[model samples]
Target: MTTQSLDESGNDDTIDWLDNGPVKGKSAPTRMCLATREHMPVSRLIRFVRSPDGDVVPDLAAKLPGRGVWVRADRDALAGLLTSKSGFARGFKQSVQVSEDLVEQVDLQLLQRCQASLGLAKRSGAIILGFDQVRNELQKRRPGWLLEASDGAQDGRRRIVGLAVALYERVRVATALAGEELGMAFGRDHVVHGLLKTGQFTDVWTKDYRRLYEFRRLTDDVWVSGTVGKNV
Candidate 1:
C-alpha cells in the first residue's frame, strides 16, 4: 500500500511501503523530502499528516493513516517546510494550520521515543541501571549501547565511557537525555548511567537516539552508525 502527498515543487510524492513502514523486519523504503527534494530512506525522514481538524502533525512512527508529507529528519529541513507563506498549504493543496512550535514538538517526540525505547529495554531485562551496575556490565556483559544523563557529572561518564571503549569495538554512548529523563524509563528518581544488552530494543533505541541527536545538535555534524566519531 502507499500514500501520496506533494514535494515543494508540487510533484506527486508516493511512499510505496507506507502501509506499516518497515515494521516486522521489513526493509524501509525511501521517501522524498518536501524540503530538500531528495529521496532518502524512510528511517531518515519524518512523516507529517493533516489531523482531523486540519492541523499539521508529525507522524514519527510513520504509521499514521492518511496521505503524508515528508521532510528530512534534520531540524533545518523541517523548519524550511514552513518558510514560505504557502508552505504546507501549497504541499497539501488545502489550507492547513501549522503550529508555531511544530519543530519543538518534533524534538520532544523524538526524545520521548528514545526514552520509550529504554523502557522496552528495561522490561526485557536488557538494561542495567546505576553507575556501578553499568560499570560492571561494561566489564563483563557484552553491552550494545551506553546511556548517560546529560546533566550528570563528567567524572563518572568519562570513566564508564573509557572502560567501554577499551573493551568494545565501538562504544555507542548517548548523553542527550538527562538523569531524571532516563530515570522515567526505569522508575527511578535519577539514573545517571545505564547499559543496554545486545538485543532488539538496543537497535530501536539507537535509531530513535540518532534521530533525536540529529534534531537537537547545534553543529552540522551528522550522526553515523559506525565508529564512534563523537558521543551523542
Candidate 2:
C-alpha cells in the first residue's frame, strides 16, 4: 500500500502499509472504515481486497495486490457491510460478492494468531501451566495476563481470582478459548489454567485477542466444554 490519499473524489491508490500491526521507523497511517466511514489508525482496522473473480476476501496482512478496502475490526461493522452488500460495491466502484463466511474467517484468523503467539511465549518459558503452577507464580509476581479455559470448571477460576484478590495482584483474565483449544499449543488434550509472563509474545497475543474479541465470539469449533465463569 507507498503514500496515497483518501478523498470523496473516489481516488484509491497504493500506500506503504505495515500489516502486522502498528508501524515503526515511519509515521503510522490511517484508513477509513467502509462501514462507519470514519478514519482510524490502520492497526485497529482490517483490510480487504477483491479477487479477479470479484470475490471479497480479507487481507489481514494488507499485502494483497489491487485496490483494497478497510473495515473496523468490529464484527458488527463487517456484518453490516455484508448484510446490505453495498459498502464494498461503493468502495470498489464495482459490483462485488462478499463472502458469507468472511466474518468467520476473520475471527478464526485472529484466533490462530493468538494461538501462535501463545505457543511462542510457551516455548520461551514465559508460560506457567496448571492451576498449582499458576498459583505459585502469582504468589511471587505479576504476570502479563491470566489465561483460563472458556469451557472449564468455575471452581478453578474462582480460587485463582480469590488468590489474586488476597495478594492485591490486579490481573486480567482471558477465557476466550476453550481448554482443549489452548491445549493444542502444548500438545495436551486439555489445559484449564495458564499464565504468561510479561514479554513481547504476551503483548502480541493480547493484541490479537482483543481484535478477535471485537470481531466475534468463539464458536463450537474452539469452545468444546465447561461453564465459563462470569465474575471470576
Candidate 3:
C-alpha cells in the first residue's frame, strides 16, 4: 500500500512501492547553492536564512521565510562555509552574525532528524530490533538497510553483518547512532542492532541517516570501524 506524506514545504509527495523498495516522488524544485554552485536535489542540501535580528540561522526544514541560502548537507562543506572568508556575508549579500556553534547546531538537528525517522519507522512496523530478530529477517527476506549501534560490541555486530553479507552479498549498514540514541527510537534503555524493512519510511530514514553518518565522520571518530558495510 502507498501513502502520501508532506515534505518540508507542506506539499504532498507520493510515496510508492517500487520493485526494489519504496521511493518518494520529487516535490520541490532543486536550486544551486552559492556555496557549492552545484545543482543538486534539495534533499541533499541544507538551507539557511538571515534572521531579522541580523543573525544567520539554519533552516533545516527549509520552511523559514525570507530569501534562502543553500549549502551542501556535508559537515566539512558547512564548516568550510562558516570559516571561509565572508562566505555567509557574501552569499546573503549582507553582513550577518554567524553563530560559532553553527556546525554543532546542524549536527544536533541532523541527529534529532535521524532519530525521529527511526522512531517513525518503528511505529510503522517497518523496523525490527535485537540480534535474533534481525538475523531471521535477513535470512528470510533482505532488509532495505541494517543499523548497528556505534557503541555495540564488535562480536555481535560482526555476526549480524556477516550473516547479511552471506545472504545478500551487500547490505547498507548505519552505525552513526550510539546505542543510547538508538534506544530512544525503540523506546528502550539501549539498542545494539536494528533492521529497517523496505518501505516508504525506510527511504525517508535513509536520507537522514546518511546525513548524520557524514556529519559524524567530519566532526568525530566515535564511530566503530568495520560496522558500516561498504558493499551496500
In model 3, which runs have C-alpha deviations exceeding 4 angstroms?
1-29, 218-232
Per-residue CA lDDT of model 1 for 1-232, tens digit only, reads 1122344565543433233332335777777777877888778778888888888889898777787777788888777766655566655766678887789899889988987888988998999988889988778865787887888888988888778777775677777788998898788889999888888887788788877876776353222453352344
Q: Candidate 1 at 83: error in angstroms?
A: 3.6
lDDT of 1 at 50: 80
Clashes of 3: 0
Model 2 / residue 231 / CA error / Å: 14
Give me the overall lDDT of model 3. 0.73
Q: Each prediction's Cα lDDT score?
A: 0.75, 0.72, 0.73
True-structure lDDT of candidate 1: 0.75
Residue pair clashes in candidate 1? none
Clashing pairs in 3: none
| Top TM-score prediction, candidate number | 1
Name the better of 1 and 2 by TM-score: 1
lDDT of 2 at 226: 19
Query: What lDDT score is found at residue 202 in candidate 1?
Result: 72
Quick one: best lDDT, which candidate?
Answer: 1
Kindly report which residue stretches of model 2 are placed more than 4 angstroms away from their true locations once superposed: 1-27, 217-232
Rank candidates, lDDT, best first. 1, 3, 2
Worst 10 residues of 2 by lDDT: 221-230
Better of 2 and 3 by lDDT: 3
- Name the lDDT value of residue 151 in candidate 1: 85
